[model samples]
Target: MPSQPPIPPLLSPYLSTAPSASLTLLTSTLGATSNWLILRFICAALKNTSSEDGSTKGDNEATTVVLVSWLRDATFWKDGGRKLGINFQKVHIIDALTTGLGIGASSLADVETEILKAITTAKPTTRVEGEERVLLVLDGLDFLLAATSCSTLETLDLVGELREHVYTTLLTSAADLPLTQSPTTPLEISHTALIMTMVHQARLVMSAKSLDTGVARDVSGVLRICKGAGAGDKAQEGEGELEEREFLYFVGADGGVRVFERGA
Candidate 1:
């Protein structure tokens, strides 16, 4: 019966280069929207790529499937905060687990099961000759320790290692292959369109200062990403060339900035 955290507002502007084709992300405050996006992408990619073609068009899927696991609680930190260098009461990880508020955060096993199920759904019949495309949409990854009140740094380390394994073994391996050139004969243009849309939604969530910033900027970003994989595309495609230019401004947490500004 943990209380829900306030859903942050959208701060980033929407990209609108491709109107007819765009990915807009809205959830009932449930974190599973990310899981759904990932699942859908995998399925679509499977359907799109010929089981006979040994190539994947998308990036690493495992890395995309991020999980925020909480291993400790506040009571453990009742003592003065000395281990983590932060106050536990200030940011309760359990609050992120309320089923309705967002995707129910769970343990490593739970996350693994969910991801495995998704992967199974898009299983490749011809392993050596088929490419399975998928993207994981994990948000708020930094909140993994939000609930742990005790010094469960060891547990945190374990989770981090687990994430790396999945990413390196499954996602990275997939990305290493040349799947983009493999023409998808069984999938629809709409399918690829949908996956691209999801990626755009993720970008918006990552870039926005808040959630309610209007889908305008987010939509614009989606279009721009779809039209061109990167943020730099000059075509006045989705919204306008100007909007596309603005989507490049990425503000990371303090002391951590992305290479956006020129010559940074």
Candidate 2:
């Protein structure tokens, strides 16, 4: 396996914005290659915020991550846990693909219900003070959107609900209120509240797809920030126009995801 690439610094502007809700869509024709890469990225990111014991350190904050996958099995993630040094105990994985075996959800509705339950359970509440964060990862959204049992509208509605819930919960948190009511505060001035504000202003949509052109050694696809959010001030300089940014990436021998500009 190729060594995994370092987390793209470009993502820092987005991921560092805690207490903000953002949705990143990973798509590819490479049979879950992009999904796996993204999963690894998230695990790596979360691991940075934790201690050697897997407990969150500093910031008095906790991140609850729930992954809903209609593909792969526990074994797949188990491998990731070992390689990434991630404590799976802190991550909730829901297998939604198995059927007739009494192991997974039976239908689309069942899947939705399970996801909702997971999100609700993982989200931080008033009982847990301090900065609470939730990261919900939905793998195989294309499958759900294409399933005959679930209408497109229904799928979209579910995503909308999830986004709204995440946004509301994070924004209403005591630590985040100043970002909304006191925009001039140090935190607000420093754009500490930028991510939350972005989440409130628009939904983020990202897509990953295979590119026929070679981007780098062993690299096969490009990821694009298609809609919903922008590159912050840089994007705003376009006179209210948001320009889409694209990146070419590949999974290295170490199972790490490496990303770079399309032509770089």
Off by over 4 Å in 2: 1-6, 44-61, 99-105, 124-130, 167-202, 214-217, 229-244, 262-264
lDDT of 2: 0.51
TM-score of each: 0.27, 0.64
Cα RMSD, each candidate:
19.3, 12.5
Q: For candidate 1, lDDT tens digit of each residue in 99-140?
A: 312224446445445545544443323344333322232333
TM-score of 1: 0.27
**Deviating ranges (above 4 Å) for candidate 1:** 1-106, 124-130, 149-206, 210-245, 248-264
**Highest-scoring model, lDDT:** 2
lDDT of each: 0.27, 0.51
In terms of TM-score, which candidate is strongest? 2
lDDT of 2 at 226: 47
